[model samples]
Target: MLWWGKEMNEWQVLHASDLDFLLENSSSPYDYSGDNNESEYCCGTPPCSQDFTFDRTFLPVLYSLLFILGLLGNGAVAAVLLSQKAALSSTDTFLLHLAVADMLLVLTLPLWAVDAAVQWVFGSGLCKVAGALFNINFYAGALLLACISFDRYLSIVHATQLYRRRPQARVTLTCVTVWGLCLLFALPDFIFLAANHDERLSATHCQYSIQQVGHTARALQLVAGFLLPLLVMAYCYARILAVLLLSRGQRRLRAIRVVVVVVVAFTICWTPYHLVVLVDTLMNMGALARNCSQENHVDVAKSITSGLGYMHCCLNPLLYAFVGVKFRERMWQLLIRLGCPEQREHVRQLSRRDSSWSETTEASYSGL
Candidate 1:
């Protein structure tokens, strides 16, 4: 199924004119080998994907390393959180889901990395599933960053008792809502992205089919992908920093640094990608410089920035380790439970801090 009946026609006969709006198309028209399947599915010159699909050697290696690191890192984070089970705080709950989302997003990178090295040979089914899954995780991760930041804001900036009241319910509801929105963002992919087989290049690609992409797509992409979460992160971190400033302690200062790092890392990794995509979307809709060089630049930027976005999966686990003292302590305990002797002394030093954090967790997110 094309996921939308009307969108089917565009796939069958995608003239260059139909794709002119999308800077995602290469500066040159996409050319597919002649075949019933190829003609019916993807028909375009490949995007100048070769120019910056990845840095080739280094990127594929990095992607592999990232996949390994992301798996181990996020897995450890999730494992520690799940160990708490019913006793999990709102912060723990958020961290669990964040790890889950990052893991899901990370799982798809191997396929993309393979594509980068050898091109997509997978058929239509994997394409649709992977594309939709990627969209869901990508959007969910972005939204959950906002949700996590808000959860922290409430714990740190608001009254303590008020923050903990039914926190389990609040976290559950927030997660459900975030997944719901992610589904909304993912649905379009089943219709838009599909498998395109080109035996000539010995490659089968998974990409968007040309259709009436313009204002609606641009608006949705802007709001859901870029604007909403950016606002949330900025607002929550700004408030958290402003409030924490009046308090005096190494802990408070550390909290400010963590919050700032969260915002900074997010901006550094995601903002360039979103902005490049946004500019491309605008050009596709005739609202920006629609020149060939400009389109090529946007495409290259999108490719690079997308890699950066994926790198977040690697960064997130480190964030968990660095930002939350409790997380590190818990991780150490988890390691010790698994019989890691090296973490024993480390766990001892963390005890005093852990107790202090536990005591004040009633007042702030120290235990989180």
Candidate 2:
């Protein structure tokens, strides 16, 4: 993973015909290169007023950066959480899953970066596997975020014992169930993504063509993965805010700030990508412009916003570190146990405060 940038360029041995195909139909990776005895094969698709070019060289750099940051941040969160799993809140379980999803997603990015710069050297099986993993993580992360928000809402706003007693079991099952659903949701990618070797380019590439699987998979992705999660998170956070406004406690106020940070960061990072994907879906379904210019814009928008979404993996662990005192406390404990002797005094102080906090109402205590 660390050496991805140097490794990605190792497969750039495009054949002469591949170079010619790239030079001719440079705008699209999906452009077919098979022999067309008839000119009609070239006639129908609209032409762009100007060539839409992207710096493919930048992709490897960008992917490498995301891989590093996301691996570090999420790895820390996962390490801390995993080390002390027996005593974490339900919300942290969702967070752990979120970090896992992001980490796995970023793991596959080097493959994509290489594919973008050159072509898909990996075969059909790998293409399907990568695609399935990507979709699974993408949807799983979004769903996990919603689950976290909802858990927070139940804890803060409703103050329900339903989540407090044996919460670990419930949360564990929830995580497992969600993961299963995500895998099922990802099956379409496994079925749809197959190598369409462009003979002219002398390159094998996985294409997501409508004729392969129709629009059902994409539609489900938009509705179930993107739209539904957004609606659930929005509702959960809104109700949380409404309840917090009426409450008067330092912990509740801190919780309010954490909720705001989580929701706002989520919106900023993911909304644009969903919007672009929605537009692209609509275009593919003939609900939007199908002109070459419009397609180029949508493709560029998806690429840019997708990178922005990738940063969310890095952003999430930062959010937890900055906003969740319990998370930070756990991290501190982990670090202390890992031989941060200088912070032993801090751990003592934390233990002292934990007992005091426990004597208070569970809400106030848990709010910490």
Q: Say which candidate scores most in TM-score.
A: 2
Model 1, C-alpha of 230: deviation from truth (Å) = 1.5
lDDT (Cα, tens digit) per residue for candidate 1, span 1-368: 11111112223343455555433444434433345635322333233222434345545676788789989999988898887645876666766788898898878878777666666667777877887787788788778778767767776778443336676787788889989988877776766677664333345566655545423544565688668888988898788777777765656656445445765787788877767766766665556645557655765566667778778878877876787677788888888889898999998898775675455542455334
What is the TM-score of candidate 1? 0.78
Model 1: weakest 10-residue lDDT segment is 1-10
Error of 2 at 178 (Å): 0.5
TM-score of 2: 0.79
Note the Cα lDDT for every prediction shown. 0.66, 0.68
Query: Global CA lDDT of candidate 2, please?
Result: 0.68
Q: What is the TM-score of each candidate against the true structure?
A: 0.78, 0.79
Model 2, position 132, has a per-residue lDDT of 86
Candidate 2 residues 190-302, lDDT tens each? Answer: 87677665443455556553342535665676788878988998898888777767765555556456546866787798788777767766665567657767766766776
Of candidate 2, the 10-residue stretch with the lowest lDDT total is 1-10
Where does model 1 exceed 4 Å of error?
Answer: 1-59, 160-163, 197-203, 213-219, 253-260, 290-292, 353-358, 366-368
